[model samples]
Target chain A: MNDKPLPETLLPLEVDGVSFRHRGQTLLDDVSLRLGHSGKTVIMGPNGAGKSLLMRLCHGLLSPSAGSIRWADGKAASDPDVRGRQAMVFQRPVLLRRSALSNIRYPLALRGMRRQQRTQRALDALRHFGLAELADRPARVLSGGEQQRLALARAWALQPRILFLDEPTSALDPAATKAVEDAVRAFHAKGTRIVMNTHDLGQARRLADDVLFLCRGRVLEHTPAGRFFDTPSTPEAAAFIRGELVW
Target chain B: MVDGNPFAKALELILGLDQVLVGIVTLSLQVSLTAVLTAALLGLPIGAAVALYRFPGRALVVTVLNALMGLPPVVAGLAVYLLLSRAGPLGSWGLLFTPTAMVIAQTMLVFPIIAALSRQVVEDLWEEYREQLQSLGASRLRAIPTLLWDARFSLLTGVLAGFGRASAEVGAVLIVGGNIDGVTRVMTTAIALETSKGNLPLALGLGIVLLFLVAMVNATAFLIGEGAKRRLG
Candidate 1:
């Protein structure tokens, strides 16, 4: 982890009253939240609860049909600087059809980092993720766990201020899941705000500082991980905690 | 008809290294390869742009390109011939009845095939890669090279398909090249000329060679594509 502070932090992400509609149907309705510059925040919900949709809206991959998402200093997610300061990892680990080293170097190159420096940083990232041996190998051919780890290493190379992961370990085995969780912890330790979406209650309990629970398209509860787990807040959440299906 | 079996004579002509047969084969390869190269240079980017960008009339453009993939070689040759004729728009170059003119005609005939096939290929790749590349801060323009590179093997098959069209067509080259004895007599035009002149053995020999060449090109492309797909994926 680079201990050097980012020049400007895009912290305190404020998503206010955002609604996303597709065709005639609403997918994420009146989603609102504020996240400061710390801790792991996991968005937990049942299937089709709009957890992934909300994260996409916040990450600027999809725009909300209604309201706004602003970072620190009122910068919109569309701001290039804000976008440059954040990174995302998808569930299936979308690695470029290139060597693992090049996959890590790609975003750094896009940020206009010079060749030598970006290569060194990419190599360091690969080493950090225990992927140094796979550096020259094509990324798409790697085992699923290694590919996801490479995805994390690629994110690490960016040194993002916030990392959004959408069910990143949904397809992984237990060992691979542990590796991804450890990588998430390392990112949080380096002060990168972690906003993840997952339906796994055990994972949320293990990693979330605050849990944003949703049922249908609405946020049911936004409570600390402890309280969200211990107390019965919403019936949907309680049912979810008890391993029962909601919606 | 020749006295011996046509296939035996054709095989003998090929193995005997007849100068005329070799020359025609070489010129055929040179012209078609050059035309395919030119078409790829122009068509790949055009296809990629069509795939990546959203503009007015995009559907119309795609439709036209797809339709043009089945364009008649003679029609393409006639268009080039008209352009290069003495009183036509590009007549100042005096490129009529030349190998360059054949190259131009074949390029015209092959461009749409390459472009339309590549558009389909790059479009599918773009669909798969769009969100991830966008997340990495890659604009659509910047993503073109990456998409093209990642789709290289598939695009190579497109280029080879264009080459196949160019090499196998007789009408385009015959019209523009005038089938001149040494200067512009490619295999297809020579086969047509020889057959019309009642020289069955020579025409059959050229036909055999042309079939072999096209088969070899396709085989090579398939092997390379499969090998690289395994290595990269």
Candidate 2:
């Protein structure tokens, strides 16, 4: 019964040096950084800089080819119970051919939650996303924004402690993007640790409490949002912040 | 004069309620239904496994099932005939010339068709469903149910095709079951036996019943297939 919560959004977790390879080409190369358990951690990198792979590695979807990624709570991220408490929202949300309500209930079903509990939780989540009106609609037929909101609602219903989003707004229009951003900010307000990847600088500025900047599979800087945006210490960070071609 | 006689006699046999003809047609439907069920029991799981799992001999199993799809009805009849004979391993069951023998032969005829077609259905499903299911943290077994539901319409067509194949086949049941006059004769066998015995009216009547059955199964399958395509929302 080690239920003692850590102080100051404790992220006593350790990632000594983690890297990933696909077909002899490196995807993430010896990237190491640290973050607290709460607030938003934005991963910003140019295309092919391995931001998506890094997020997957953090979420335990893809195993790193080298080094270690250990959670400080002494639970392996791959454990079902631990993984159950973590949910990832993909760039292109994959939806089941079911009603919107059922999509929200799916993760609960996996955890073997009670039927009544699942129904109430799903309804609550849908209402939060302003999707209670579309509860019985087929999730596959929803618009891009609606589907993304449903994805968020489903993830929220899981009560995830660590939420990973891989460019959730990249596929959305500006208005739809604003809607999803508001949902992310609301989740962050409730103390969920957010790790998201994005190329939208304005969005990163709006949502990021800290930044993890990467270039060519390596971490160039892991800095506070205010300082990193004002005067980047590293050359790569400076070039990236200035909107210069880093790829 | 003989053409009118044959036509009138066949109509009387059908409209006047011939008991033997009616009994044979009913037995035919019952046996084919049971055979299709048995084929599904044997073939659908095998097809799904071959479609989903990547074991050592999966390719060989699929190849054999595909080759068996064209197995001659007479050859299947001969094989079942030998297996149910007095000297065979299953002879203790005393199944020969009984309705059971006809069912076994017909099941064999339909098994390969169901297996081969269902393999196609399940393979396509795997391509479409595997990643989505896996991402949802669904296990291999649970993922299969989702995949199966997605391709259920295709599996439905496979089953109807199997039933059609089983009901229309003659050589297997005739050779294996011997199509005794009262006990084992079905629509196809009774039609064959009556035709050879110059009972043109009875044979023609059974033929009409068969033509009606084949048309019905095909029409139902096509309708369901089209409906599935239209209702994908």
Candidate 3:
């Protein structure tokens, strides 16, 4: 797999009639949406709206109880080659007890890469996030913002084709939030597909090419950024953007 | 008319026949050490596997091992005794009343404890660390071992505990070892036999030594546990 033509493979994603429920109450109900390549798709929804569940389903973490999710390149959700080309950052990053460089090198080692190549890749990743100074520090000891940055650095160092983030910066302080936003924009500049969920409308406007507005286990609309904010197609989405307690 | 205090007289007996007492304790040490090493080798990987994978029969294996964790020591001894008896399959080895038989019974007694605790430690790690590694493209097998390394401290403490339990228990060794002097007799059995024969001083001395041994094992375990906490913290 050559890195030719600068991001040539932009496989779209398809969700076909995916449905999930718990104890008779639906969490995601027959949801269908298409994710195009080379753009940020921000998932915006109110609390208890199942936005995170949708992200997990997309990233192949949760197996949907009904229907099927397929990639645009006709790969099934369980395919390792396809899944390996994607990465995710949770709301709170999980760092290993080892050093920062070791954390970055973990996935590479899992792929059976040789020791010297693994170390080089890890060093390159550390330098990218300005974590080179702390390469030997135990990853669990980094500050909240630094950990999230390191998590992003590790994910992106693999050059994954798609990155799914579940409110990655929702827990950070304002200063840290800016750092994470800067990282996200850098990845965006690299033409990596970004699918993210956030409650902050300001963040959505800054990051999204299109908005996937969700409410109560349903997709309210798939509207462009400008129209989604100014003239939401649904009453629920408009209320959510305005912080009017859609729930 | 026997004695004013059995423990007091037992101490005298232990001091008088110091060689016998020493021999018993030495044999106990050898057998228990061997059993624990064997248990760790056999048990840790199986425990880790059950904790990290979700295949068919996984739950059943965990449940059975958990049930075996409380297996009575004498019952384990009896089970092993039967297997190694003349009429049983393993009788050809002539191991029915030997130190080897005692080791096997003790292994049976504490193998479950090591395995069960190891499973608990590995499972806790799997629950917490699986998602992060999976997101990083770690295969299930690789991710599980990494999780085990994260919980290395707990696994170490588990082994120490297994050692203590195996070395200190009497019921299993008493049944399978036959308590033959200079051949199968161990510290626990000698302590019991000397007491029954109204040997108070030797029994008291051995009892004190046994207590000291337990204290040392626990002290070592505590220090190692603290060291692990510092490294991982």
Candidate 4:
């Protein structure tokens, strides 16, 4: 589903010795992994495994207590230009108190896009996501699934080089979950690197090209999607895949 | 100039558009509106700045502001009176008994309310939108307008609160203004003077008008807020 080639400058995200601590508690303890040039990478682990915290640290929403996160072979991840080329969707959608269309338009507006251009881009995005009819409604009032769709649509409108999702569909029912998965697949097809985290192993199996299996704030396994599922490396990963409590 | 039931006399003056009443109303509006505008101009940015950034002494500033929200008008008036009074530091300007002095007093009294309230509104919105806005590539400065616009309805209520404070205040305006007839006398000050003179009707008249003005300001703020909510939603 390649729509356009990704910019060469965006590839090969690198995390090295990154650790995050808050109030003397280590949330992510000296974890490091390299995400190669392309494809959808899913992070899976039991609850409290720091999956969400890791994504936020990578997304630059939170600074790591130690070490660094880099993209494109040592390009600082937190640089505004780099961050501008990226987007992150939280578990619960964070929408502006604006119209559905305005929510889509806001990021574009922030980039100094002209009003007319922002309007048209937002409209195109809404239509692309099949949210055109809900365009004028306040984004906050949308049903949970709809708000998630709108959030994804807003990210889509930015044409980000990297899209980060933290449990994007965790709160959705089956149908809604499927819809979000479809959107994620479409983004991957469009050549935006997808880094996501989910506890749903079924979803991980369906969408991951590479698996980053974290447990208890440490990386227990990073392997190809098929191999990670077929020949589980760690006892923790195996226990997790079998739906046993592994923490 | 006339005697009888003060309420009826007040009505007659109001209905007859007494020049004195008209002048008083005009000056009251001029003074209070100016104060509100000045305070908002000074307060909103201060509030937004305080809410959006972490600086040294921020907690102390916020605490002081919260405390100052209830500053007595008399103290504010007394302070301005001191500042602008003859033989005082600012006495050379001779602003002590003028409408400007009342505006200055009201501004000092109400600035904290507008700033403190806007700080709260912006702070709440900042919590909600901070991550979202930052992810959108907005710097703290860039995010202020967005947070302020999104919280405009609540901010407008803050403005109305400041307006109410400025308009209804008597002690500060009275002490600083000297309640000069046809000069610095506003509705509140006029009411005080007229009541003390046993001119109950005129005092009652001014009181009614003041209440009406306050009600109108509050009603307008509510309607605008509701209109925005409905239209946006």
Q: Quick one: best lDDT, which candidate? A: 1
Give the alpha carbon lDDT tens digit for every residue of B92-163 in model 3.
Answer: 888989999999998897788888888899888788877888788777777757876777778878788788
Q: Give the alpha carbon lDDT tens digit for every residue of A160-189 in model 1.
A: 999999999999999999999999999999
Better of 2 and 4 by TM-score: 4
> If you assessed candidate 2 against the hidden native complex, which CAPRI class would it receive?
acceptable
The C-alpha stretches of model 1 lying farther than 4 A from their native spots are A1-4, B1-3
Worst 10 residues of 1 chain A by lDDT: A1-10
For model 2, give the TM-score of chain B.
Answer: 0.90
Residues B1-233 of candidate 4: C-alpha lDDT, one tens digit per residue: 55656667657776898788899989999999999999998998899989999999999999999999889999998899889989899999989999999999999988999899889999998998888788888889988888888888889988998998899889999999999989899999888888899877778877887787788878987997898787665
Off by over 4 Å in 2: A1-13, A233-246, B1-21, B112-132, B194-208, B218-232
Candidate ranking under lDDT, highest first, comes to 1, 4, 3, 2
Q: What lDDT would each prediction earn against the true structure?
A: 0.90, 0.81, 0.83, 0.88
Error of 3 at B78 (Å): 1.3
Each model's chain A TM-score: 0.97, 0.94, 0.95, 0.96
Give per-residue lDDT, candidate 4, residue A166.
93
CA shift of A211, model 4, Å: 1.4
What order do you get sorting by TM-score, best first? 1, 4, 3, 2
iRMSD, model 3, in Å: 1.6
lDDT of 4 by residue, A30-148 (tens): 99998776799999998999999999888888889898899885778777668878899888887877899999888888888889889898999899889999999988778999999
Sorted into a CAPRI-style docking class, model 1 comes out as medium
Candidate 3, superposed: residue stretches over 4 Å from native: A1-10, B1-27, B52-60, B180-183
C-alpha lDDT of candidate 2 relative to the true structure: 0.81
Off by over 4 Å in 4: A1-6, B1-14, B86-95
Please give the lDDT score at residue A185 for candidate 1.
96
